[model samples]
Structures are given as structure tokens and as C-alpha cells.
Target: MAKFISFAISILFFVSTASAAPKSDLWERWDLSNEASDVQVSHAQWSIFLSKYAAYVDPATNTRLVDYSAVSHKDHRVLKAYISMLTDIDPLSLNKAEQFAYWVNLYNAATVDLILDNYPVKSITKLGGFFSFGPWNEEIVEVSGEAITLNDIEHRILRPIWKDKRIHYAVNCASIGCPNLYVEAFQSSKLESQLESATRTFINSDKAVQFINGKLILSEIYNWYAVDFGDEKSLIQHLLNYYEGPLYQQLQSYSGEIEYQYDWKLNEKK
Candidate 1:
């Protein structure tokens, strides 16, 4: 009886440990070594697809609304082919900037493919597993022999490896709360300016910052990932860097708590 009880305890311990372990730590393990600078990455296909399907609601806001309903059979095929091509390319063989731009485009294209696969749905969270909020956990793509998910692309690959807060603007969540999905594909040649533009556009947008009831309101992104932007003071300084006009001047003298909110509605065209 004593031996049997010991065996049961060992089994219980194993079960608990296994349950606590995350299935993947791809982000923690990613490291890019300097490689050949001339490796070819064709963003033309992705650019063409985006121009045809994505539309800006208002140029002033830079808000993009995807026309998921208008995706033709050919366009869907093209995007799938592009994603497949990405999986075959080794990031280790490309320069760091190229790899960075590659992952961003691949992630965005894959997300659009997933949403197009289940179009007409009210929200991306509605698709895939009935018990989950969205397909963030599902291993939906393969990259250089490793299976990856949307969560892996964002949290693991981009956020952890790049360690850039501006990355938040680059990876779209297919929801209104997310930064506007850029209609142009990211390219290594233009990465710096692209990242800067994305960050500035999002920081200045009403979706990210708003003044309400004599208080400051910010996107839940700033609240949820506060650590990424450092402390509250750091966040305000970061915003000031991009903001100009009256908003910048107003923040210069304001010291108060930031209220946070997010909209999860699918950013689809009407």
C-alpha cells in the first residue's frame, strides 16, 4: 500500500507539471545571425493583393477596413501561395532587416487568409474552436519545419525578438482595437520609415488616444502591455515624441491616470 501511494503521488505531480508547461516557447528561442544581404523576398504579390482588397476608410485617420467579402477566388489562391512561399524561406539566411519585414508581412497575410477562409463572420474570434475566443492558439502555419500560430508570430517571433514597441502597430489583430493594417507590404528597403509611420499614425489616432471628461483615455494596448512601453511616465513621453499640434501641448502639463478601452469588432468594410 505504501508503494502504491507513492506511485500515485508521482503521477499527480507529473500531471500538474505537464499542464503548467506551455506547448511552445518559439519566441524565447529565436535569434537571427547576420547573413547574406541579397536574399530575394518578393513583396509584389502581397502588395497586389492588399491594394485590391484593403481600403482606407479615411486617409486622415489612416484607418484600413478590409473587404473580406470581396476577396475573389484567384486572390485567395494567390495569398495562400505567398504564405506557402514564405514557409520555405529560411530566416537564418536573410539579413536581419529582411527577416523582420518578412515575418511581419507573412503574419499579416496569413491572418488575412484565415479570416478570408471564414468570411461573413461577425468576428475572427467566432471562427475555429468553439471553446476559444479566436484562432490565436491554433498552429496555422509552418515556417522552416516549425509549426507556428498567430500568437507565436506576434508574442514570440516579433515582440520578443525585435523588442520594439512599434511592432504593435505592424501586426494587425483584424480588429478595430488593433492598429490599422497597412495596405502596403513591409519591405526591408523601407522598414525604418514604415515602422515610424505606423507608430506615429496609431499614436495620434483617436483609437489610441482620446481626451474624455477632463481625463486622458488610451487604448487597452497601452494598459495590457504597459511593460513594453516602460512606466506611465515613459508611455507619456513616448506619445509626446509622435504627437504634435494641440494634443502634444496639452500633454505637456497633464499628470493623471490613463483610462483604457478597446473595441473588438471586426474591422470589415460595410
Candidate 2:
């Protein structure tokens, strides 16, 4: 099954690129014809996030990684079309408040595609080399008419300005601890609801915290961003807010073994 899947990926990669021919580019450097799905990102606000945030992995050493430039032409056309919608729509045209949220969502989603592009076989940590910070690259995105790094976005904009610790949960780095990447583009109207849903979904998922054998195995994200999840509140409280159904109740008074682990593997075509 694995071999066939990989083979199919290979065929799709080449076939899609055959008809490439177009002109004019957003962010200027990247083109759509040869690399259409790259139309994956838009919005001038998101420009900063893509320009500043997102860790870039070196494709040379990362043999097991998925060459996004290759396969982006295929897989999930609706999602790609939505991204194109972003490009076609004038972000400046949106209201100031709406524009900010639009950029944030675009940046986060585009980053997901960037990681999936190199979506590697080993842990995401493995993708980063000696000089690399993590398996991500801030360079994959284009923003503010300049290419920026991921560190800039996280430390500078998202964390500081938004001041909402829960945001850490909203932007999935395609890591296990992160909220699962939303299948579609995050629209401005849905920002607040999206963040709330993303927080709830990620915390409750098996990847973050799970109720198994009367124990609570948690994700490292909780530990790393414990303060963001309201370090003021006990870990139990944090979990309760983000989880619902039985899990919420189970965590109320439940004390069990605490386990934390993360998966860096790309959330590829399942």
C-alpha cells in the first residue's frame, strides 16, 4: 500500500506540471503555472506571517519529505481553489479589522502546506539541520513584499499583538501538538469561532490529550504553552475548557498518569 501510494504521488506530480503556462505573480517571486498550488497563500496581512513566520526545511538532505512543488498540482482541488480565491480577492479591499484576521489565517494555513510540502518521514525535528531551529521555515511564505521568517511572526506579531494565548492552538504547524489544520481557508467572519473550535478540537484530540486506561496522556503543547492555556488555571481547568462531552467530565476530578508526546510527521493524504 505504501509503495503504491508513493508511486501514485510520483505520477500525479509529473502529469500535473505538464500543462504549466501562465504569467504575473503575487509576492512577485513565485509563479502559478509551474507552481500553481503555491497560489496557496494570499492576503497582505498574512504576508507578514508568511514572510516572517514558517520554518523552511532544506530539501536537499530531507529525502523522505514530500516535494510540495511537485505534488501541490494535485490533491484536494477545492482547498487549492479556495487559496486561489484569496489571491484573486484584494485583501486591502477588506476592512482593517477583517484584514488582520484574514492574514493570520492565511499565514497559518499556508505554513501547513509548506510543511506538508517537505512533509518528511521522520520527526519534524529531524528535518531541521544543525543550524535549523525546528523543522519549519519562515521563508516558505511571502508577505509585506519581503520574505520573512517564522520566528518573527510568532515572537513579534501573533504572540505579542493578539495577546490571546489561545492563538498558539489555532496555528497548526502540522505538528501533533498543534490543532489539526483546518481543511479549508480560514475566513475573516469565522476567526473567533475558528479559534475557539481549533482550541477545543486540538486539546480534545488523541494527539493532544486522551482518556485511556483511566489516565490522561497529554501533548507537549500543553506543557510548552501552559501559560497561554491560562497557567493561572490548573492543568485540569485548561483541559476542561478545551474539551467537551465525557472527556470534559472525565478531566474534572480525574487524576491519572500524565503522558506527553508529539508527532512531527506531515499530515499527508490519508
TM-score of each: 0.87, 0.59
The numbered model that scores best in lDDT is 1
Candidate 2: lDDT over CA atoms? Answer: 0.51
- Candidate 1, superposed: residue stretches over 4 Å from native: 1-29, 58-62
lDDT of 1 at 241: 90
What would the TM-score be for candidate 1 when compared with the true structure? 0.87
Local error of candidate 1 at residue 40 (angstroms)? 2.8
- Number of backbone-clashing residue pairs for each candidate, in the order shown: 0, 16
Per-residue alpha-carbon lDDT of candidate 1 for residues 1-270, written as tens digits (9 for 90 to 100): 999999889878755543231332346445774565687699899999888878556554447889888889988998999999998888778887888888899889988899898887787777667445677778998877889887788777777677888988898878887898986999999998999999988888888887887688888888777868889889898999998646776676678877988887788886
Root-mean-square deviation of Cα positions for candidate 1 versus the true structure, in angstroms: 6.4
